[model samples]
Target: MTDRAALQHRLEQGIATLGLQLPAGAVPRLLDYLDLLVRWNAAYNLTAVRDPAEMVTRHLLDSLAILPYVTGSTLADLGTGPGLPGIVLAIAAPGRAITLVDSNGKKVRFLREAIRSLKLEGVQAVQSRVEDVQGQFDCITARAFATLADMLGWGGHLLAPGGCWLAMKGRRPDDELEALPPGFALASMHSLAVPGLEGERHLAVIRHAGAAAAPAAC
Candidate 1:
């Protein structure tokens, strides 16, 4: 088998073994994405992991672990570095509209190429900081992006009245939770069991109450 085929096999086995439910059709697209990531990293340095096997285990499965907790018709990825759960979620949830935002122009350009190469629909990558972007979204996500407090402060205005913030973190951020403003409430905190990832992974689902309750303060 070729490298991609082996990677696919590992991904399939890993998902099945981990008992994670993934869109059946997304596997191929993910393989294509991994291939592109590896190629682009040579010039753009999109990710540190170069091995396809490691990408399948670390990046792909780790991203998919959040699949169960996300709820929204549309989603935006804040600080979408190389499209980590954003692109993965877009593939896993094809029906949802996904917009990936990033400050790095090179990364944004890579995201656009990945979208096109993967044949992903309803996905767009924009090169802009979260503060500069306009319009609210049904859901927003950040994976290893910022502190809960900072993400809340920056992403607060972007959430639709009843939208959610899906923040992926390594350890439980108790302090960040305590520091959160009043308007947003903790919807749920799902501990993720990612295949091949040995450390802690938690997906925090936060709901926006209103600006009155939790004023967007710097």
Candidate 2:
């Protein structure tokens, strides 16, 4: 099989392992997105994950692992370098308004092209630092972007009332969670298992301190 075809097989297996029900045509488009990233990374150095097969496990599957936790109509992916979970989420579950934010011009440029090429409606790419970007969103996602305090401190204002913030991390961020600025509280925490990924993965669900409480995830 060709390299891309092999990558497709790996992704299929990973999704199956995750027991996800993706919208139709998502898998193909995801592969197409991977193809785009491979081409662009040659020049822009988008991601350190240089291998396509590994990206299927590390990037695609890792992003999809958070799909179950992502809720709401509008989402802002802060510091979304080359649209990690942002683009991946947009492709997997259609119809959500997704804003892919990045300070790097090259990354945002690639994101715009991906949004256009993939025909992803309601998805926009913004080239700006997290602190300067404006607009509230129902769901916020940051993948290994920064410490919880820094991320919440910079982009916390963008989180709408009753909305949730999803922080993807390598392991349980005990120290960072404790250091979360006032007005933000942990809603729930989930351990994520990505097929073929060796290291630990965790998702921190946080909500505004004043928001109404809800039942925690099972």
Candidate 3:
């Protein structure tokens, strides 16, 4: 069994080191998610990383690293596999309603269970092609979904007016930015310093120049 107290302390330390201050109640929720992820991974193969310590450092903490820059009321996660940043964002920002979108049925299944088992409110999992979904959101996020161009092509429509896309990329997305179709401008880029992780990570915040529409068109 996982040591709950140890997990809580680790999460606390991770956030603190990253210069993030989360609410006191977020710890239990984080612990609950870590537990569920471990249990479900055994059956669903949701993730390859099975060690709880590594998961805290890699998945949960890494996801939370982008939380400080996410600006939105309701967020949409494109190609969410087992709800990385989406579920973590929902838990971190309790008031933000998050919709987790994925094309894989198995991943969506795991996402549904994660949402249910964690009793995560304001979180809905949708199994659909990212470009086919129709809904305007305050923010759109994708982690390791695809190349920046493809991700933006599919998920760009989901952004609401005056909203932005928080695409987490490893290195600077210069080539991907060049491939962007139109009406999008680079807003800001945040170099992520994930606690206990090596190498460089970044969160590219891109904004639309014109009005935003639903994700029905690529």
Best by lDDT: 2
Expressed as tens digits, the lDDT of each residue in 101-127 for candidate 3 is 999999898888888887888999999
TM per candidate: 0.91, 0.97, 0.91
Model 3 stretches astray by more than 4 angstroms:
210-218
Local error of candidate 1 at residue 81 (angstroms)? 1.0
Identify the superior model by lDDT, candidate 2 or candidate 3: 2
- RMSD score of candidate 2 (Å): 1.3
Tell me, by TM-score, which candidate is best: 2
Model 1 lDDT tens row, 1-218: 98778888999988787676677777888888888888899898888888889989888998888776667688899998999989988887788889999999999999999988888889999899888888888888899788988888887889887777888999988888998876887877878888888889988888865333322210
Task: Arrange candidates, best TM-score first.
Answer: 2, 3, 1
Residue 125 in candidate 1 has what lDDT?
Answer: 95
For model 3, what is the C-alpha lDDT against the true structure? 0.84
Candidate 2, 152: how far from true, in Å? Answer: 0.3
Which model is ahead, 1 or 2, in terms of TM-score?
A: 2
Candidate 2 to truth, TM:
0.97
